[model samples]
Structure formats: structure tokens, C-alpha cells
Target: MTLLSYAKAMNRALADALEADPAVCVFGEDVGAGLAGLTLGLQQRFGAGRVVDVPLSEQAFTSAGIGAALNGMRPVIELQIPSLLFLVFEQLANQAHKFSLMTGGQARVPLTVVVPGSGSRSGWAGQHSDHPYGLFAHVGIKTLAPATPTDAYGLLSSAIRDDDPVVLFAPAGALGVREDVTAPLVPVPIGAARVHRAGSDVTVVAVGHLVHQALAVAEELAGEVSVEVLDPRTLYPLDRAALVESLGRTGRLVVVDDSNRFAGFAAEVLAVAAEECRLLAPPRRVTRPDGAVLPFALALDRALQPAAEQLRDAIRAVLK
Candidate 1:
């Protein structure tokens, strides 16, 4: 078995996609140099035309990607940092996302935006530490956050082939995750949630990299509480059926998300659980504070983000 790191998995997915499809191409600022590691060696193998490096302008390159998608080219845009997503919000949310709906399904923008390092990086401070996947999900754009190396490869492969616009966030924390690969990588469906560990006491729905934390917490509390760890790999188009099924067995819910508290991904999960499923007690969520800004200090950053301890407490509280 081979050990595959998350970033490498994404790199492999891109390589495979480029090799399989003549229309598949990539665009970014330093992609030609393979600066982000995900696009490493891609330009050399695919040539400069397919892996084109553009200006530093995020908006300009993003707009170009939309145009390419409209003209039958499947373009993948790599934004090195997550914060740059704010710069192209209008282009993604208003333009690329609306073309199919506004045109009555006539226009299809097969654009894939990948943020290799999303969420808080050490000392990156407030400006560069935003995890805004919820914002895109709110606007009806397909959003993905893969927790492991396998999902990273599978989801990205599927995203590149999707007809509509898709945004996939590879969390800064999960980038280092490595998996023991025993089989050939395959495309993961867009709206499936994987239950990493099954339990009967409570179901802990974790998003993105927090899936790891939830699994760790579940292991630690195994003797006392039976915690089921559920990873919502696809943020938007959430697999509500899986969620409802998990809740049916456990009758309790806790969501751990990296986004802010108000109208965040966790909030939406809680709403869905409360509305369609029966609960033994009020569901709880462990998430970053309302409108939280990560301080420059790493300690403060850790404190603001959701922790395993917070998850543990929520799990215990629901059992009371």
C-alpha cells in the first residue's frame, strides 16, 4: 500500500484529469512554477498552454476561467490563499453561478476553484485566515471540503468533471493528512457523507478537517460515550439523508465547523436536524465564535477555533 498525502492526492487528481480530457486546463498566478505544490510538475507534463500561469489579479484570472468554461474548456482556478476568494466573490457568485439559471439551463460553466490552503494558518492573522465556504454554499454554488487524502482526490476529480461551477476547499489543517492507499482512487459523488466511526449514543457531524478532530475525540471518549463521527464532505448539497439516518440511530447531534457561528455551516446542519429529525435533546454546535477574527498570535487562533474539548462537552451534554 502507498501512503498518499492530501496535497499529493490533489496533485494526482489534477494530473489524471488533465491527461484524460483534452479540454481540461488550469489557471493560476504561480501554477507554471508549481508554487502551491498541488500544481507541481503539472506545467512540465501538460505544457504551458494547458497549465497557463496568469497575472496576479484573482478577479481577472477568475473571469477568464468563467469565459473558458463557457467556451467548452474545463478550467480549474487555483487560489493559493483562501482569502483571495473574497476578491472574486462577484465573479463566482453573480456571474458563473447565475449563467445556467438565468439562461434557463442553456449555459453551463464547468469551472472548478480550488483553495489548497483554506482556514487559519499559523501567524497568517485575520486577513488570510478566513474559512468562507459557507458563503458560497449560501449563494447556491456547489461547495466541497474534503477531510482526508482519499476524499481530496475523489472530490477534486469529480469537481473537474462537473458541468456547473464547483468550489473545493482543502483545509490548511488537513493538507498534511496521509492515507494508506490499497485501491485505485475513484470519483466520490458530490453529495455523500461518510460515517468514519459508527456509534449509538450521539452523532457528531464534522465538516472539513474537523472530521479528524471528531474522530480523535470519539476515540478518547469511547469508554464513556459512544460517539459516531460523520464527515459532511460536501458542504452544500449536504447529504441530508445520511444525516437523518445517523440521527435516527443516535437521537442526538453535534456539529463542529470552522466557520463563524451565525448562519454558519454548523448552524445550517443544526437547523436541518432539528426540523426533519427527532432529537432526545437540543442539538449543540461547536464552531468559531460569531464573526470571529483569528488573532496574529497562534495561541489565540487555536482558542477561537473549535476544539476537541468543546466537542467532548457538547457530546456529553446531549446525553444528559
Candidate 2:
């Protein structure tokens, strides 16, 4: 078995996609230099033509990716920081995302947008640190937030092959995860939920790096309550069936996410339970406080985000 870190798994996925498809190209700031850990050695492996580096303009480079996609080339644009997503939302949400529908299915923008370091990168400050997957999901853009090394490789492979614009947020906190792979890497379907732990007492839905925290909390509460940790790797096009089925067994739900509480992914999950699943008690969520602007101070930053204890409390609250 090979032990692969999350970043290394993504590197393998990009390398395989490049080798398998001539149409796949990666463009971004400092990508040729592999400034981001995930793109390490990609330029040398794929050549300057395919793994081209672009200028500092996020909007221009993002629009260029859309243009490349329109001309039948699949482009993967990497943004070094998550907050840059806000700078090019118009290009992504308005232009690239609407190409297929606007052209009546004649044009397909097979563009994959990658954010290698999403969420609090500790000292990145408020401007550089943010997790806005919910914003993209709100506009119907396909969003993926894989929690493990294996899922990182699989979901990325699937996103690159898809004929639509897909946003992949590799959580800064999840990048350190490593997995011993005894099997070959394969594409994981975009809209699937993985149950990390099976339980009959309560179901805990976690997003991105929060999945690991959820699992740990579940283990801590194993004797008192059986907690099922469900990771919705793909935030949008959510696996509602799996969620409802889990709720059938547990009758209680707790959602954990990094985004702000208001209109966040957590809110959507709770809405799903309210609409379709049978719940024995009110569903609760542990998330960043509403309208949270992460303070620069390390202590203040963590205070604004969700914690393991908060997740446990939320789980217990739901089970009551």
C-alpha cells in the first residue's frame, strides 16, 4: 500500500488526466512554479504548453479558461487562494457556467476551477482565508469538497472529465490528511455522500475538513451515543437519498460546516431533513457564526469557526 497525502493524491490525479487526455490544460498564477503544494512538478511533467502559467488577473485568467473550454479544450484553472473566487465570480457564475444553457447545449464549458488552499490557512488573514463553496453552490455551480486523500484524487479526476464547470475546494485543513491506498485510484461520482461511521442514534453531516473533526467527536461519544459521520463530498447536487436513508436509521441530525450559518450548506442540509427526512428532534448545526468575518488574531479566528466540542453539543442536542 502507498501512503499518499491529500495534496500528493491530487497531483497524481492531475498527472493522470494530463497523460490520458491531450485536451486537459492547467492555467493559474505561479502554477508553473508549483507554488501550491498540489501542483508540484506538474509543469515539468506536462510541459509548458499544457501546464501554462497566466498573469495576475484572476478575472482574465478565469475568462481565458472559459474561452479555452468553448474552443473544445478542457481547462483546469487553479486559484492559489480561496478568496480569489470572489474576484472572478462574474466570469464563473455568469459566463462559463451559462455557456451550455445559453448556447442551447451546443457549447460545453468543461472547465475545472481548483482552490488548493481553502479555509483558514492560519495567518492568511480575513482577505486570504475564507470558505465560500456555499456561494458557488448557491448559483448552481457544481462544487466539491472532498474530505480524504482518496476522495481528493477521485473527485478531482471526475471534475476534470465532466462537461460542465466544476469548482473544487481543497480545504487547507484537509491537505495534511494521508491515506494508505491498496487499490487503484478511480473517479468518485460527484453527488455522493460517504458514511465514515455507521450508527443508529444520530447522523452528523460534515463538510470538507470538518469531516475529520466529526469522526473524532463521534469516536469520543461512541459509548454514550452512536454517531454516524456522513461526508457530503459534493456540496451541490447533494446526495439527498443517502441523507434521507441515514435519517431513517437515526431520526436525529447535526450538520457541521465551515461556512457562515446563514444560508450556508448547513442550512440546506437542515432544510433537506425538514422537508424529507423523519426527525425525532430539532436538527442542529455547528458552523461559523452568521456574518462572520474572521479576525486576524489566531485566537479570534478559531473562535469564529466551528469546534469539535460545538459539534458534539449539536449532536447531543439533536439526539435529545
Candidate 3:
């Protein structure tokens, strides 16, 4: 078994994909030098043509990836910052994602947009700290946020192989998580949720880095209330069946997400549970304040983001 950090695992997965598939190519700014660590050694393994370093135009390169995907090539575009997604939303949501349906399945855009270090990173402030996966999910794009190294590797591979446009958000909070991987790395199918901890009292659905917080809170509440930690690895094509099953066992739900409160990912989960599931008490969502702009100051930024304490309180409230 080998222990690998989430960041290094991503790099390894990119290298593995490049080596295994001749159709896979990557394009982004600073990818040649591996400035984000996720592309380290990838340019060396694959030539400069495959690991391309494009100009600073996000929209151009993003559309170019769609063009490449249409031509039977799988293109993985790396966005250095998470908020850059806003700059290419038209390319991803309107163009690459809709090509299949718009053209009646005549074209397939196998483009994977990987945003490493998404969400807050200390003093990166508002511009660099925005977590906009909810926007993609709302737009019907395949969206995934991997919480562990193994999931990071597996999900990235799956995203690259899928015949649709996919957005992979690698949270900054989860970048440090290390996992002991024993078996050979394989692709984890999109739209499957994993139950990290089983409990009968309350089912806590956590997205992205909040999965770790959910598990920790579950452990802390073991003596008082049983808490189940549900990690919805793929946010867009959520495994609703698994979530319904969990809600059936617990009869209570709490969602912990990194996005803002109003119309965020947490809001969608709550809406779905309210419509389909039978809950003993009102479900609660622990998320950032509405329209939060992550301040440059440390304390202010931390306050704006969701915390484990808030999740624990939400769980307790839901169980009560």
C-alpha cells in the first residue's frame, strides 16, 4: 500500500491517463511548468503538444477543448483558479455541455475541466476563493468534488473518459488529505455517493472538503446521537437513491457545504429531501452566509466559511 496526498494523487492520475490513452490531451496556462502541482511531471511524460500551455484567454482555450473533444480527442482543461470558471461558463455550460442534446447525439464533447485548489486558501480573498460548483450543477453539467486521494484519482479518470463535459472541483481544504491506497487505481463511476459512516439517528450529507468535517462530527457525537456521514462525490448527477436510502434509515438530515447559503448546493439537497423523503424534523444546512465574499483577513474568511462546529450544531438541531 502507498500513502499519497490528494494533490500528488491528482498528478499521478494525470500521468497515468496520459500514458494509457493516446486521445487524452491537456491544455492550460502554466501547465508546462506545473505551477499548480497537479500537472507536475505530466508535460515531461507527454510531449508539449499533449500538455499544452495556452495563452491567458480562458474562453478561447475552453472552446478549443470543446473543438478537440468533437474531433474524438479527450481534452482536460486546467483552470488555475476556481473563479475562472465564470469566465468560461458560456463555453462549458452553453457549448460543450449542450452539444450532445443540441445536436441530437451527433457530437460528443469529452472535455474535463479540472479546478485544483477550489474554495478558500487563506488570503486569496474573494476572486480566488469562490466555489461555484453549484452553478455547474444548476446548468446540468457533470460536477464532482472528490474528498480523498483515491476518489480524486478515480473521479478524474472517470471525468476524462466520460463522453460529456465534466467539471472536477478539487477543494483547497481536501488538498492536504492523505489516503493509504492498496489496490490499483481505477475509475469511479460518476453519480455515485459513498456512505462514510453508518448511523441511525441523523444522516449528514457533506460535499467536497466538508465530508471530513462530517465524519469528525459523527465520531464526536457517537456517545450521544448516531450520525451517518454521506459523501455525495458527484454533486450534479447526485446519487439520490443512496441519499433516500440513508434518509430512510435516519429519518433526519443535515447538509454541510462550502457554497453560499441561498440557492447553493445545500439548498438543492434540502429541496430534494423535502420533496421526496420523510423527515421526522426539518432538515438543516450548514453553509456560508448568503452572498458571502471571502474577506482577505484570516478571521473574517474563516467566519465566512462553514465550520465543523456549525455542522455539529445543525446535526443536533435536526435530531432534536
Candidate 4:
């Protein structure tokens, strides 16, 4: 029922969660001033106690979230840069994520670690430009990347409510996208994949911001071939059933992911398709080159990340 930017949608989602549940709290560097833009006005509405700002110690604050979650608080920790995740990997992968299973399901950590602007953002360079969702996914942590404003709002709400630890990667590419949403904002269930466009010739599985590029490419090739655009909103518990169903119809697959090619999210999708799906040709993945470190130069940075043209070429080759 409103038009909202991707960043505003996430801000609204956080506000909604805070208003709806008293137990839901947020902590991160600069959240008090809403530096990431997703927490703007939240600290004012919820007060400093609930929307607290922490020191610069990412490792300490990340584990503090785990501790808060253990005490029945739903804590959302925002990382200003995507690579900050690496700084707190042990806290998340070992402490928060493993609590539920390690305790034999007796304890649950409802913690949401949000990377607001992941992937290369112009000249942010190597340290700030990493899209590391695949790393979290490989560790079996609940991972999500919503491509649209609506999905951003819905999925973030769901992630906060989930019993397990969830990591949300809001790509820099999608941060500026705005949508005219008529329906009331609501939670989108995790582990569900949405078919953005239906087609019979090929299925293009796109992750995070790449979903928009995939849809655009699908439309551009509409006359030549029917390309199905599939968005697996949740990366960890990937909607394998939906993937298999799409593959059943399309018989071909091409994945566009922002992460690196080696053991990346796209690689996992291709690997699964190879193991279980019937394909007309060898599947292809469009991702950042293996071990790619985005450079400070704009052209060099753009070259390292997967492009729409690359996806189109991959789709064309897959259909060939």
C-alpha cells in the first residue's frame, strides 16, 4: 500500500518488528544515528535501551548478540560493511548458530545478522565489497538475500522471528530500487523460492541483486527463448523442491550469483542440479571469478562482479 526504497523497506521492517514484539532488540555500530540508513528513526522510536549502539568491537558485539538471544531476546546486529562478517565468523558460526543443535534443541538463538549493503559498491574496494553469503550458507546458518523492496521487508521480518540464527545480505546493487507496493507488508516464509518469471526453455536461478538482472535478461530474450527467473530468497535451506520443479519444466539451468565462483552459491545450485535434475545441456554459472578481490577502480571492480551480459551469454549458451 506504499512505495518504498529497498533501504526504507528494511527500515520499516525493523520498526514493525520492534513495535510488534517487545523482545526484539537491535545492536550495532552507529545504529543509534542510523548510519546504515536501515535503522533511521528506530533508536528514537524504541529508545536507546532497545536500539542500542555498541563499541567498534565486531567480535564482541556479535557474541553479545548471541548472549542476548540466549536470554529470549531477538537481537538484530547490523554490519556496516559486508566483510565485517569475517571478523565475527567464529562468534556467529560457532557460538550463535551451533547453540540450538549443540544443546540438543533445548536452546534457540533467534539472532539476525544483517549486512545492509553487500557486494561491490562502486569504489569500496576489497574490504567492503565481499558478498560472503555463501560462507554462512556453507556453515549451515540460515541465510537470505531478498532482491526486491517487498521481499526485503518480508524476509527481514521472517528472519527476526525465526528460532535459528539468520544472516541477511542486502546487496548494494539493490539498495536503490523502489517499488509501488499495494498490499500490506507481511512476512515471507524462509526456505521458499519465488518464480519471478515462468518459462519452459531455461531456468535462470539468480541470487540477491542478480535477480533483477536475470529478470531483465529473461525479458530481453523472451522472443528467442522462454527463460524462467527463479529467486531463492533463502540460500541455506534452498528451495530444492522448487528448483527441481522448475528444472522439470525448463530442462536447463543457469545461475547468476554475486559471490565468487569457487564453492559459491551458484556452484551449489549447479552441483545439486547436476546430481538430481535432468538437463538438456551442461549447466552454467555466472559468478565473480574464483578468489576475486574487487579493486578500487570502478572498471576493475565492475569487471570482477558478474554482469547482466555475462548472464545473458550464459543463458544463451545453456540453451544452445
Candidate 1's TM-score reads 0.99
Which pairs of residues have clashing backbones in candidate 4? 1-182
State in Å the error of residue 94, model 3: 0.8
Point out the higher-scoring one by lDDT: 3 or 4: 4
**lDDT tens digits by residue: candidate 2, 67-186:** 999999999999998999999999999999998999899999999999998999887778888899999999999999999999999999999999999999999999999999999999
Q: Name the regions of candidate 1 deviating beyond 4 angstroms.
A: none
* lDDT by residue for model 4 (1-320), tens: 57789999999999999999999999999999998888998999999999999998999888889999999999999999999999999999998889899899999999999999998897999999999999999999999999999999999999999999999999999999999998899999999999999999999999988888998888998999999999999999999999999999999999999999998999899988999998999999999999999999999999988888898899889877
How do the residues 1-320 of candidate 1 rate in per-residue lDDT, one tens digit apiece?
A: 99999999999999999999999999998999888878999999999999999988999999999999999999999999999999999999999999999999999999999999999998899999999999999999999999999999999999999999999999999988999999999999999999999999999999889999999999999999999999989988999999999999999999999999999999999999989999999999999999999999999999999999999999999999
Over 4 Å off, model 2: none
Q: Write the per-residue lDDT of candidate 3 for residues 185-276, one digit (tens) a residue.
A: 88889999999999999999999898998898889889999999999999989899999999999999999999999999999998889899
User: What's each prediction's TM-score?
Assistant: 0.99, 0.99, 0.99, 0.99
Worst 10 residues of 2 by lDDT: 311-320
Provide the RMSD of all predictions against the true structure, rounded to 1 decimal.
Answer: 0.6, 0.7, 0.8, 0.8
TM-score, cand. 3:
0.99
Error of 2 at 297 (Å): 0.9
What's the lDDT for residue 34 in model 2? 87
